[model samples]
Target: MKDAKNVTITDSEWMVMRAIWTIGHATSRELIDAMNELEGWSASTTKTLLHRLIQKQAVAQHGGSRPFTYKPVVGEKESMAAAADDLFDHMCAMRAGSTIAGVIQSRELSRADIANLQAILAEKAKTAPEEVQCNCLPGDQTC
Candidate 1:
């Protein structure tokens, strides 16, 4: 897959990706079965989504048999982090902390998830500069 900001995955595509990510590698038949069990998607529907994913370079196909196996070309963490960065960039810098706090309050985070977030924050704190610079161009409204 391309950089997280450039990767535009639909909700349906995310479902198929999650299945492949969880399963490591899977045949089209296996993908259909897993997606059907997970999202009640029909085989034809799953196949179509799989094809789209391949075209997007989000998935890689392998095996020389009748039913080719597929695996994710992009890692889940990379995708999520890129998407989160894209989202965070849209908000005002001054409200970033409050926005993140609001998100934390809204979600039911697991203990592990909380721990991971804490660890990431701690690491960032250690290396964070005194001031962050804005790289926006003259006509960019996002800044």
Candidate 2:
């Protein structure tokens, strides 16, 4: 299995990955049907996406029969974290806190999730810098 941080999954591919992760393992027909139902994708379109995933080594094909099983080669949680990190890396560092706050405000988090976040923030508060510098360009340009 390839590490999630090393693989770059596109948005469409992420949709397919979500389905595969939710299903655990499935055949092409199963994926085709799921994609069709969820995204109104054609069988060929799903097949193409599957082929691309296979090429990227993010998914694997198994069994010797006509209807082979496909499983994720990358983990869902790890992939999501990596994607989030990638997104944050492109944004101004100073805005990350407020951006994260916006996401937390918009998303429905469980009690445990909120607790974990609070713990993490409490720990970070000890050594966190007073100000975060913007890194949008060379030197000290702000976004």
Candidate 3:
């Protein structure tokens, strides 16, 4: 399966995406106006951002008015997960062990989050055989 669509946002595009995500839905004019205050952007800039978002399948458009209304096409969870995966992939590709260690060390988890992650790890460990396994190959190990 493909990764989630939302993390596809570029740094610049994220500003636009946040606006759309926050509004849920807004007219292009409204968006442009909103961005002008935060970014001092021109209408054309907002329009370009909209086009980029549409191309990425991150934003949805509707209405036949002069300016269409746009909304976020990706759900919040999908967006967050994709963002996390993207960051993880970058870190892994760079230096896997250090990246993982840094994440564990740096993250500020709530009690619930810590408990949940611990429970999940325990469950996986219990269900899994002793060795770490790859299920992709024909001679796959215990996965």
TM-score leader:
2
Where's the lowest-lDDT run of ten residues in candidate 3?
134-143
The runs of at least 3 residues in candidate 2 whose Cα sits more than 4 Å from the true structure, single-residue gaps closed, are none
TM-score against native, each model = 0.75, 0.94, 0.64
Instruction: Give the CA lDDT, 0 to 100, for residue 128 in model 3.
Output: 66
Per-residue alpha-carbon lDDT of candidate 3 for residues 27-108, written as tens digits (9 for 90 to 100): 9889889989999999999899889888887887898776688888777678777887767655323344456667878989
lDDT of 2: 0.94
- What candidate 1 gets wrong by more than 4 Å, as runs, is 1-5, 110-116, 119-143
**Per-residue C-alpha lDDT of model 2 across residues 53-103, encoded as one tens digit per residue:** 999999999999989999999999999999999999999898999999999
| Residue lDDT tens for model 1, 56-122 | 8889889887779998988888888877887788766655777899999999999999999999999
Clashing pairs in 3: none
Q: Give per-residue lDDT, candidate 3, residue 106.
A: 98
Residue 2 in candidate 3, Cα distance off native in Å: 10
Worst 10 residues of 2 by lDDT: 134-143
Error of 1 at 73 (Å): 0.5
Task: Count clashing residue pairs in model 2.
Answer: 0
